[model samples]
Target: MSYTPPSWSPPGQRPPGPGPRSRRDRGLTALAVGLTLLVVAVTGAGWYGYGPGAGDERTRAADAKESAAPESTAPPSTGAASPRPSLRTPRPVRAPSAQELAAARRPGEAAAWIAADPTDLPRRNIRVDGPWTVGGTVVQALYREVTAYRLSDGAEVWNLTLPTPVCEAPEHAAPDGRIVLALASSGSRRGARCDRFQMVDLRTGKAGWTKELLRDPARDTPAIIVHTAISGDTLAVAEGLGAAAFRVSDGSRLFTVPTENPGRCHPDRVAGGSRLLVSATCALGDDPRTRYSQLRALDPRTGAVRWRHRTPAGRRVERVISVDPVVYTSIDNERLTDDWRIVALGPRGELRRTIDPRPKGFEHCVNVGIGAGLQPCPGVVVGHGLVHVGGTDRAGAYDLATGKLLWGVRAHDGRTLTPVGFRSSRGTVVYESATPSRPGRTFVLGEGGAGKEETLMNHPAAAAEAEYSTMAGRVLQAGGRIVVMPSFVTGEDDRRQPRLVSFAPAPE
Candidate 1:
């Protein structure tokens, strides 16, 4: 018999279903319950992907079952217990070494060896480490950590240490690998100051700068800015109150964009070079309570208003900035089905094109997981000429120049998927498949979502638990390689370590 603990539930709240459940629902419910339970303890290396109490539950349950068993002694046997069988301990997963990695490299690889050679493919180095966050802000909680890797052959490289015990997730990394921005909480009881911003070194993991974020006291709850995008050497921070930009090199105040009214806004990306695009969702007036959402582009250098493309007031624009020249996002209102759209903007914030996968009514919501927006969506990466977006139900490739959908495929639910770090030989989209029962697998989705789709990683050891407590995100480096931080679900005192996994593409 297998040992399965009761499912994980939110504090004080019961699991989704009511009372006793059927046999079939038990497994699914267990998986879902475990997902939440494991999420809290799952770290790259913190607890071996299982929380501290995970094995305890199994051991306790096994002991209870054993106690009820009938015992019989062989006739005339000595009054002593039988010796136990030798336990086959699980082996540790070893990552590829730096020397083994460099030996497989090719010549003339552009910008971190990102050009395609195709001869040497799927070189990987896997590691297990503490937990870390991507996209928001990097936090210092015990489980909040990052695992950096090489894309060419999945070689584990570096890891980021959090400042405190809490986490401020990272939205994205700077293109030049000089600075990283994160969202964090001050952990105040009075809610006096909750969210914070941090600028850190990409290579050395040192604090480049830090700032306390606040919102207008007039309306809504005061909150700190969460999302950011780096353009050139500048960083743009967004909040519900307003948006601001800072020099990435020195964290110097570059400019500020005040809000028209005290409303919610978030910075998503630095469009082209001169303009910054933000997702604005705010109130029409303080009275009867009306809301409006739109995409606003501003000059990051000087904080000048460029343009605002208004959309339906009720449908909040989730992310106004994107990897491509245009921004992409999805909307789902009570009165309407879920729809996807991309808004292309010129340097002056002129609307160039609007591509809508209108009325698709996707069953998945962006809120379900990280980077789950109608726009960029999760795992969809946009480069010089193409856009890639993937979800549990489907994955699509599109041409950035024509707003045309190139190709798409169906896949499992994934936490993070982006192009291999930086550049390499082929136009590849690397993605991870995270599930409740299996060790998440990574794939190299090539041009047109083609090439090898589902390649098994054969991670060395079984995760401590079947579920992942924390979120998993990835980054693309210069050489067409892949970097990924695995989900963490363990405690701080486990022998099994956590880490980042890097996979480098083979030479052409």
Candidate 2:
């Protein structure tokens, strides 16, 4: 006899609207009902009281069914847990010996070696400054620690943990490689922010000293660390409220100069070249329209002012780019006109010459963000015994001695080229191109009036999609290397992973 499962009808309903059911059918239906009632009673008893194996068989059957189902076609989740960071102490970095240093300093050898063997150091926070070279080592600021690595081999040299997270990137190392300065701030509650000035030795990676610079609980504004420069034994720091000079040997205050108006007169630059030039803006009165610029050359040894130069009324000095016997200043008044003037100052803070370097039919210049703030772009860069002026529509190079235009290039097809830096030793000028059709291109203008363009993507050490800005002090050239720190992007997922890439200069 064939065993068949049965279906039951309600008491008042007909039996499936058919003839009378058979005896086998009636027996199967009663068995099914009895089994269902038994299951319900067992499940209810297990849920209410306790049963060791109650529902285990049913759960196993359900799990087996789920396991045999087809796989999903959607992509894997990116939210998977990341590997934990190592908590063990970092291995000690091997220092270069005297013989290694001598071999690494040979002409053209260091760059070629570094190019062939590129070093990549993973960073945690991308808001801080990129890597900087001091002597033969590259110093980088990691999460809460600053690490030094050998430039040639990428070996860890030494590391120092900061008391708090770094607020700003480390400033450029002095020409002689004495000290590195940076600003660090502790996490604040309410409005109280604690800021400190930290200095470290370039050779040994040892911290020299740290000083408390600003602590204000009432004001919610962040600490503005404007400029940091080291010359001889003196270190100068310029902030929003004022500028101060400190002795590097010990964290002692040398001299302080408070701005005339903190809101109006902001510190521009602290050039520690031949002289310490602390330039700031001084508003004539409450109105921002009547603001004029002031330059005070201070003695590096003492905080005494060497000389003071004030611009005429209605003019403001936007930037002080370079100070090598000649002080190059960028002056403009956007309220009155759209043109900008490149004013050259002598060592004595006397106005030398003002050259208007605007294109004929250009409309207005745009502000490009650099570092922690925004500054007007298409400005001037002074180097290689020449003054390179950039504008919205065109760029030109002028002789530094005579102020005569040497060569000019105009934008074509909505593409703009701006001078990024000048290789004075090689007698070649480097410009970055902004073209929508292709990736960024680097154009090198030679002394013979020839321009060669190369796509940055093709460059071995360049970033994936590299770009440059006309911000005065963004590019750093040291130790036969060009270090570019681009403006940081915003948004949670859109931010670029901050990286400092070193490239060998283009062949002359």
Candidate 3:
């Protein structure tokens, strides 16, 4: 579906925006948006610039947005602006709600959540993944089942149960909503190999080809599973020293990652999404046994190496933050648990910049799995030509191109900001923040992420505890609702608290 950029104006503001137009005018929005960025870049305080054209915030933001999702806003080659699914990512058109959010303000009374899932106590601690929003459907997988719900209201849409709990899922799926998931080899979780697989259409609850990934007699063993990522039509699964790509629609093997050397160098981990990357560990010069890790950009369909980047000795690529412009963290082999450095790579797999979160006073979330665990950093929001990092006292946005500090905002007296996503589609960012006893708050920063955050919605105190329960889960805004769900559901009692809750503007 062609993207319908949302028309948004912050609270207490009446800035004018262009009215509905033809495809060409819509495409020109980017240029107009860029001009706006230039003005903000020069005037916005606490912002920084570097490299050629330091004032060209428009170009940088545009480049970052395009790089994250290519051809997102480019005009069609010939046809008049039409609803072309392949041309751009689909985005919902959310109405401005500054008035309602302000008019219905309440001190408490569960004002935060208008809808939620009924609380339940499951016997075991089931591993949960997702809250992925697709075509207005919010989906989640836990134990042996995958379920979808309406984004507007937490109402069930459909459910698909698997023989075994899902062992792996991609961060994003094909533009058409197709996804391949790996299941356990057996019902028992102990020593289960995630070889069984299935493809499902996220939009509809239809299941596609389901089969077990065959281990190559010549290359792979009976064991498998880590992270699964999809670029276009190809899905790549990575494990220890093994990586393979397959056709996304129907489970067809594309290619197997070959070992670089008989035993010295091998594939270690892989990451996918708009790009495919494989990390390899190589032991060279046997006398002292020098070791290092290499990141290789591979063609999603052909499995051909497009480029390779070797890290300094003793540092291995630990987690992949993104693959398009390649963001990752590497640590010294000896200091595996510490010394985490966030790095960004150019399109050519060249090292672009690195940020040490410790010195910057920011922290990233490590949402890795028990297995391959690649592409695991979810703590920071990577987009809009900047990476949003979180620090206890304040949060900062770092330029992905220059790695320079852009702007930092101190947390409110009782709340912490978590950059959710660029929902406004106008360069301003939306954030969800709250304290344990305080109601959740939704706010949007000024255009270019430079101005003070204006409150968009505020939940009532009655829902504070429920909102806090999902603090560790993914928090994002969809269809004008703030969704907060646990990343994983454990056996710990919920005390009948809602596990998945959505907060919307209070009814006026």
Candidate 4:
């Protein structure tokens, strides 16, 4: 039950334990040192060598768990109470017709499809977040609504709905697509309480500013578990009782969180781009040796803090990974063992090198779950200044000035790499591999991380088992296409298990 309704707390706040949970068994149960991820594949291999071929699967059909309404014998005997049986809503699990997904494509592979849930299952575990591919469209949120699709043929274009249940989002959307959801003020599928938020416009589903979170309802206490970050136009937001900012083009407000800190430290979580970090902790008056967990540096328009950095009394700040030359991902259990590092900061924060992706089998800095904020690594990828580490090996890089480890890219015969972004102004380093055989490709490296990698697209072996299931943060790759899906969806699964698979490249 890990969609974490109140439990997703372990990425950073550990005076004792519990945090970072919700690979979703249905939601709720997170907070502190519960990391738990073993993803093993950025998108390819191991789920059983990529299910290797699984007897060619393709029967798929699990979605109906209801359709009952016929039982009135006792009422019949009583002669009157027998007149109430009207239930029937089980017909949602069909998606597969972009011309039968282009006749099950297989030529150099790249026209596969799927991403059509039509809604119908929910007794628990809904919280599906995004795939978020701006403008030409590709968003997703599901629960309170926010669909988008249409990256050429995925279709559906525009949904937006919300009134509750969306819990949190913010990975890429203000460059004009404008998003910033975070609902869940209370609808309890398992507890609810993300305080509240709105502001939409994924290229026009339109809905602008709606609020609810409190900055001081006497002293504020709503936020059950929230985390956001936008940067540039400032959006910030952290929860439990600290950190706030807004004004990403009209939400206004721009600064809050300051009931009194400095050593009282509270901040909860934030990590916008260009720079806006924050992740305080302080531990107040319990003294497990003064608790400690800093990494501030606000000022995303006056939330002003500037620089604090602290993290050596018990060490915490877990997972941020890139905020204008300030990477993150720390954790230090001490005597119980379990160290994990990745640091990197340096723009005025200090500490420019720590990296220890577990000696290189790379944990992608503890994976994270449920809309994880700061920056969910998903096989990491911070610009060419260096710091790239796909799900595991076969695609490494690090050296944000000297955290060293400079290179690792082998997959020509291995076929399962995973790195994912970067390529403008010649930054290079974009990768992907997935394999069931004969499809799923993406390459490009040469430039600082070191020369020659190039490939571009192949994607088709009938869509490599729906592009090897999901997760490399559910994979993206906008307009040119690469979709694949599942950040959350739990009616139970097994109806062939591939809800949103895209591939594209066959069109042109």
Q: If both were scored by lDDT, which would come out higher, candidate 1 or candidate 3?
A: 3
Scored by lDDT, model 3 comes in at 0.58
The digit string of per-residue lDDT tens for model 3 on 291-397 reads 67788888888999999898877767877877766888776544342345778988788888987654444433422221135655644667767777643334566
Number of clashes found in candidate 3: 5
RMSD of 3: 18.6
**If ranked by TM-score, best first, what sequence of candidates would result?**
3, 2, 1, 4
Task: Write model 2 residue lDDT over 1-508, tens digit each, in one string.
Answer: 0111112112233222123443433543454345334432432111111111112222222223323434334332232112111112222112223244334332322221121112232222223344567778777664356766665544568877777555453244555555644544543212322256677776777887776654334543444334566656777776543677777778678877656544656554566645567777566343444667777777788878777788776666555556565544443332322334567777677887776543222222222211121122333567776776644334556666666666655543333345666655324444443221222234455443324322232222122122221111234444555444432211123222223334443344
Per-model lDDT? 0.39, 0.45, 0.58, 0.57
Residue by residue across 1-508, what tens digits does model 4's lDDT show? Answer: 0111112222323433323432331231232323212221122211111110101111010011101212222222111111211112222234456786587664455666666565664543344567777767787876777888777777788786677667678775666778778777655544455666888888878888787744346644455556887877778887654667888677777678673454477776787766778786676444434576778878787877787787777666767767777887776523211355778877788887776655444443423432245565655767767777764225666667767665555433323355556766344445464432223467665543434566666655544544444323356666666676655454544332345777766766
Candidate number achieving the greatest TM-score relative to the actual structure: 3
Ten-residue region with minimum lDDT total, candidate 4: 57-66
Clashing pairs in 2: 93-156
TM-score of 1: 0.54
Runs of candidate 3 exceeding 4 Å displacement:
1-122, 216-220, 261-263, 284-290, 366-372, 391-393, 412-416, 423-430, 446-451, 492-497, 506-508
lDDT (C-alpha) at residue 134 in model 4: 73
Per-model C-alpha RMSD: 14.4, 26.7, 18.6, 23.7
